[model samples]
Target: MSSDNPTPTPGGPTRRPSLDETGELPRFLDSATSDEPIGNVKPEGDLAGRRFPLTTGFSALVRNRHALSTLIRRDLAVKYQATVMGYFWSLLEPLGMAFIYFFVFGIVMGANDKDVVPGSDASFVLYIVSGVFVWQWFSAAVTQAANSLGGQSALITVMKVPREVFPISVVFARFAEYLAGFPIIIIIAATFGHGVFGWNLLWILPAILLQAMTLVGIGFMLAAGNVLVRDIQRFLPLVMRMLFYGSAILFTMDRVSDSGLGQKLPWVTYLYEHNPLVVLFQMHRAVWIPGLAPDQVGIMSATFFAVIMMFLGRWVFYKLEPRVLKAL
Candidate 1:
């Protein structure tokens, strides 16, 4: 080599990134005017960003089921852990609520005027219990989803996993707890001999699918909002309370027919059909209670709403996720 050949430094440069003595090696063409990365390992820059589409989001959510399921189980454990009895409270919640509704609707006002009685033929309890079952699940999902982000602030602030997963998992956790009471519902309906049976009973399955979709969508949206607005957690219960009475849970929608204003009410029918949660309640009644349930229109409407709620809610959640950590 010629004497002019470049001499290597005796003590080489440190492994850390920096400008060379001549500021030449590994330098960019626009180094003087740019803030672009000059290191081998640049920041991922808002890693875990939301650039994926709806399908990808859902697929990712599904893949994270273990994390989701753990949260759900933890919630259930925490819920009963504070109470006197543990799992028994699950059945007690609906049963206690059912008794209250029974007194108010069935006994207090003599409101079981439609002969909505329970027997080997057709049970009123089953009709009412079906409503309780579906409503509890829907309400749980909604209520939990709304508070999910706020509740998981610690996890959100520290964890590397998806942020949306926290709220979505909360919804699922509540759902799993809500479902724990279902076998009791089915048994009550079956024991009285007033149950509807056979292949037709399967129709409730579709309504359930619709209801689940609706809950997930609404859950994500509520969870996102709850993170930003602390008041939402308190306000959501009030909203669900009103919805419970208006949702046609204890009594049939036909019960409103005697009052012309409620009967002639056009939107009532629309809400009944379009709200997937309501539709699931009515669907369970239609399949479980023999010779009851007016028509299938409500279930159809609910299915439609479920589809709309799911897509829109998911979009909103994805849109909000990037800012969620900051808000939390």
Candidate 2:
């Protein structure tokens, strides 16, 4: 007459006991395993109590920063090794791009007359350099981030570190390179007779940090997406190209906003204003401009979005990471 049930209370009906209940409180004449608790058996020294694997993603990032930095240095060094130009290419890349763009748009195409251009009083060189300067850093970071997971496919498949680290590290690595190249832009600006630079202009620091956050967020999302759908590699380039046009790459934000074109697409106006890269440009112009320092409103907004995106990105990455590894 015994059943797989807990001993009834003195005045209560029979109830089933939890798996943890003692054998005396539960029994079944026919259920052979009923005496056993159903659960994972513990391994000795389970130093950290077993817990959600998701938190492990962030914990790994914090614990493995040294490993992360080594990966970043390895990536950058791979690009520089055996090249005669070595690190010179980092500073030269944006300079070469600006030169080509200037010759094509400002000199040959007469874009200087373009009202959408800012700093018309300044040399066309300065105006073009500024936009190129802004666009290149972000572009480089995005490109690096997009390919980050794919590049580390081996490390991910072979090792147990957080996969999100690869993409975020790529963004961080490119940001470092961007920072190193920043002096090149300022020196060129000063040499061109367009800027009155000072240490006070260093307000650009927070703006740069905010931009890196946006990159990390978008990079994490894209990297996670790319893990399963390989064609994203193709789609991302097109998206980035469109971003350059939508952002202030070849024009001034004020000119683009005031051109009455944004009126046609009110939603587009909001998106442009809200995008991280666009915010950075506004902040960049404020600091890089001759007399401007930085906009408090712009800095606050950029920092806020940066934080939101970083958290959101890490959340998304952690949530998707388990499935993402399966694909790899």
Candidate 3:
């Protein structure tokens, strides 16, 4: 007579576990489910390929905060471990960019003669350096986050940790770099030509928070999209370059707003004012110089945009996360 039952593998069943059970119930269910019930059962074989919702993604991140923090520290340490200058390179990079932009634009192009900040004592050098410092933080965070997933394939494939942690870690690590360079900016602002300090420096709190939110949103979208289309990785640098020039990094938004181009096309003013980076740069400069404040309307608009992008990007990341892992 034929055997009634097929033999199991040496240790267990031959078939793989359901992705829902493998991914969700055991880890996310125990604590988070106490408040919000999770009805996700072991998904059937056909349905197991689908992605989890945003709730699951957020829960995973919250549960893994310690691991996430460790990853951020490890990423930062590994980046500069063997280097001579080490963390000092972070300060030098933006400082060097400030000098180059100051020479080429402020000195050679005579931008120094024009007053970007009306009635403020700050000079072109101060303006460029302040903007460059913040821009470097934003660019480096988003770029590193975009590559975070692809770069940590070994970890992601083997570890039970949340994938979102990888991109979020990149954002935090780059923010650390920004924090490292901040004191230098303060000294430069105090000592350099016409740069001044005032109570407005408190505005930096909101600016950093808003910019961090914007970067996290960008990180989510790019990290997931890069997995599906590797071409996104190749094209990202070009996109960053376009954003750099378009965002008025070297000059002030007032220059754009008051320019002939801005006069002819009112949309140019609308566009720059609505941009998160423009709003951020304005806030940074306001903090560094007295008698300057970011446009209230622009700040409001950018904050709203940042919130939308944050939710939308998280949705996209969680939606495609399964496909991303499968492709890898």
Best by lDDT: 3
Reference-based TM-score, model 3: 0.81
Model 1 per-residue lDDT at 15: 39
lDDT (C-alpha, whole model) for all candidates: 0.65, 0.65, 0.75
lDDT of 1 at 249: 88
Clashing residue pairs in candidate 2 are none
* Candidate 3 local distance difference test against the native: 0.75
> Model 3, 15: alpha-carbon shift in Å?
42
Model 2 C-alpha lDDT per residue in residues 1-328, reported as the tens digit of each score: 2335456777888786542344231221112222323123221242223211233556667876765776678678878988999888887888788889889876777766334334444555666676676677788777777778766664444333456668877887787777777787777667863654666477577667778788888888778877777798888789889988877666655555666768777767666666666667756655556333334555567788888888888788777776675555
Model 1 steric clash pairs = 117-124, 118-123, 273-298
Cα RMSD, each candidate: 13.5, 17.0, 9.8
Give the Cα-based TM-score of candidate 1 against the true structure.
0.75
lDDT of 3 by residue, 64-141 (tens): 787687678778878898999999999998999989998998878778634666666677777888789889988998
lDDT of 2 at 322: 61
lDDT agreement of model 1 with the native: 0.65
The lowest-lDDT stretch of 10 consecutive residues in candidate 1 is 25-34
